[model samples]
Target: MALARRTLTPFGLWVFGAAASAPMVVLAGGIVATYATTRVTALPLTFLLVAGTVAVLAVGYTAMARQLGHPAAYYGILANGLGRGWGVAAGMVALVAYNAIQTSLFGLFGATMAAQLGGAWWVWAGIALAVVGVMGVRAIVLSTRVLAAVLTVSLLIVAAFVLACVGRPAAGGLSWEGFDASGLAVSGIGGAVAFCVAAFMGVDAPGSFVEEAIDRTSVGRATIGGVVVLGGVYALAAWAMGVAVGPGSVAEAAADPAAGLPFAVLERLGGWWVPLAELVLIFAVVTSMLAFHSVVARYVFAMAREGVLPAGLAQTGSAMRVSAPRGGSLTQTGTATVVVGAFALAGADPIGVMFTWLSTLGAMGLLCLLLAASVAAMTAPARVRGPQAGAWEWRLAPALGVLGGSVVLALMVGNVGSLLGAAPGPMYPFFLPAILTATAIVGGVWAGHLRQAKPEVYPGIGRGIPKTHAVPDAINVSI
Candidate 1:
């Protein structure tokens, strides 16, 4: 079946991209950790820096999107710009990175929900996996709505918390310390920047839905909008944290991030919404998981259609041609279930094993993907007829993205122990890169085999472009 084209509006794409960021989780959990590590009152500034970097990358990224009109994310850009072999390698990396992210969320969700609702963590994880699976099989519109609603609630809670902080600032009294660079000179600034960058990881997610956007322009707008919104929201919340507890004492206050320090600040500031905010955070994580689920499914579908995976995995829903990747969704769901169940059976600590290790690995892998994509954006073939970005936007911005992403990747690797919330060890630090390298080698070898044995499918590695099929036209924009 042919996929539908132009089924999603700008707002839907924005929500999907932004929700994948899990703003509330970052505000409530990630920021606190950053603060504890960096002891930097200017954590908000770090967020702005990260956002600005991404915005620059988007200038070139969106330009490429307009030119290529492919919806397979990095794989498409890599294939068209770099080569089929590199694109195949990227596809393998993306699948593993996104799946790691999605599965890692279950650990956080299960632990949080179990703490609040009085149940086994595995029970909560299992339930979430099942629910998200169902949602993943539904129309993209449905998932967008769910994400939009949850994101709205989460943002409102953050807004309320910020207001309370501003109303009752600590001894320093709502200073602009967080904006000053001097305040960021902590012992772990590298780790802090890496985490901040991790928090902005989903800025490119909107591009994955370009095939379904109401207009190709919507993809660019949605991506930029999501980046700005997440950046602004995170900055505000982090600033509020600094204000509420006094910048100097932030590290001490957040010494125990697992204790939900940010929400505790809200409670202390006469904000009676702590419990409600916690609930919103749970929903935020769920929405984030669902968003990543959708991203992974699309990758699977795109690869399947290109013959990198089984073609059956590309099957969409019958009711809507551009609807969900039902087969891919089911496949991801089953994989997550088995992984989560195995951890449960082993009586593992959900937070330590599933959340920390997997999420850190995913974050590092994503950084690598972003770096490759930025290079692709700079070198990709441009369209002769369509709108073209200026030289600075197309060239300089992607160059900067490549530089910045490389630095962050290095920092993440050096601070792998801190990122994983564990002591430094040879295995812990080296495992992720080894795995990524191995996958890339496997994918390249596989692509070479396909080129030799099945030349017809080799060139179409990331071409989720338009053609006649059982899918709807709305979801098949040309590559």
Candidate 2:
């Protein structure tokens, strides 16, 4: 069999990097959850936590990336600093979490479009998943290009919707006066922030292709730049909806922002354009689901290849030649399928239940990964401490990152029960994070002490990691 090429030009890298992060802007179900909170609670505190957390994540990620060098380097550093066991453990959690989220979104895509298509939602979901899976199992360039086309068209449609609503009346159309932040609750504020933070979660994914990024030195810049683009898009989408419909009615409209708000506005401006806007809204969700599914599957493949999970999860597809690890990939697909099946069984609203759970879990996992990464950053390279290290690692940076991530994690975990009302696996709040953290700790202890037993593998732990080059490179990447 011919091996699929692993080549990714610098431009291709940027596109993939941006597309990987694009899902955060579109398919992010967390925004719906946050809107519900704002409508039910206070908006000011929600704004503070949401704004504050992303700002912190941005700083921490940038500083930590400087030391780690590249995406894989970040993972490698975690393995080296925390122990290989921990690296595998963190990688596993990330892999599973990404797939679950992607799969859940698949259900949403199916159900939403099904309603419009006048067919079974699961059928739509199956169709959507099939498309995503095929793309996911193809070359990175192919996947990125498809995602870019979907993303650009989807965005243009939304932009048009927003512009059409500019001068509409408050009663039935655009109403900027309703952007209030007075009703937020302390818990609700934290919850909203947790959800919004999910929008910025995929910025680090492109780093997975560090070995293939056009310019290694540019990885950090590109990653950070992606975050900024995500933030702006999210803010615009939120503001446009918040202003047009008013926070008061966000509840009923929360189910689908693009369709709910933008469609309403379009109906007022040019009634004939309403259907077009709604179609675009549907496509946006589809694009997001496809984008997320591809990246998450890739994550599973990478982790399995590194032995974080069983060997099976890291198996690459014949076409993509970058398939997930064997056991990990199976686990990812299984988890997603189960969730979608359950939603189908419960006859529950796919977008509300499955989407919420996936986004919530994604949020929690993201915080956990950041915390682990930060700790690793702080602990790595202990033997070479000095201004050089201080300037590079920003030990303080990771420390702060941990603190910031911890706060977000705590808020989300604490309210998991409250948010979901104890349905969807009654033990989720306590169990999921415990599983994630425990897995990492166990892996770390195992890897760190393996030197006493498996001495051979121990010595080469840091070798071949994308970030660690014996010679100088342009990406200025470290990990």
Find the candidate with the highest TM-score and give its number: 1
TM-score of 2: 0.77
Q: What tens digits encode model 2's per-residue C-alpha lDDT throughout 1-479?
A: 01122344545545554564454344234455567553443332344445455544544444444444333434554665676666656665665566655766776677768787778788787776666555555555566666667667656665665565455433566543323455443435655665656666666665555554445546556656666665656556665556555656665677564555445666666777767656655665655655556556545554444444344665554443332223333455556667777788888777667766666576577667767776776666654233456543446656666777777777778667645546445675576667666755665676666557657656555333333322232222111
Q: In model 1, where do residues sit more than 4 Å from their true spots?
A: 257-260, 268-272, 319-322, 383-389, 424-427, 469-479
Model 1 agreement with the true structure over 1-479: per-residue lDDT tens digits: 34456667888888888898888988877888788766767788988988877776676666666556665677777787688899899888988888888899999999988888889999999999989998898877677878989988988888888888888888746678888998667667777887887788776788888767768877878888888888988988888887887877778888865545777767855656787888888889999999999888888887887788888998888544456677778989988998899889999899878887778777777778878877887777655114645767567878998887677778778777677676656566678788889988998999999999998999777665656644444553222
The CA lDDT at 17 in model 2 is: 48
Report the lDDT of model 1 for residue 327. Answer: 75
Model 2 misplaced regions, further than 4 Å:
1-33, 40-52, 58-74, 169-187, 247-259, 308-349, 382-393, 421-429, 438-455, 458-479
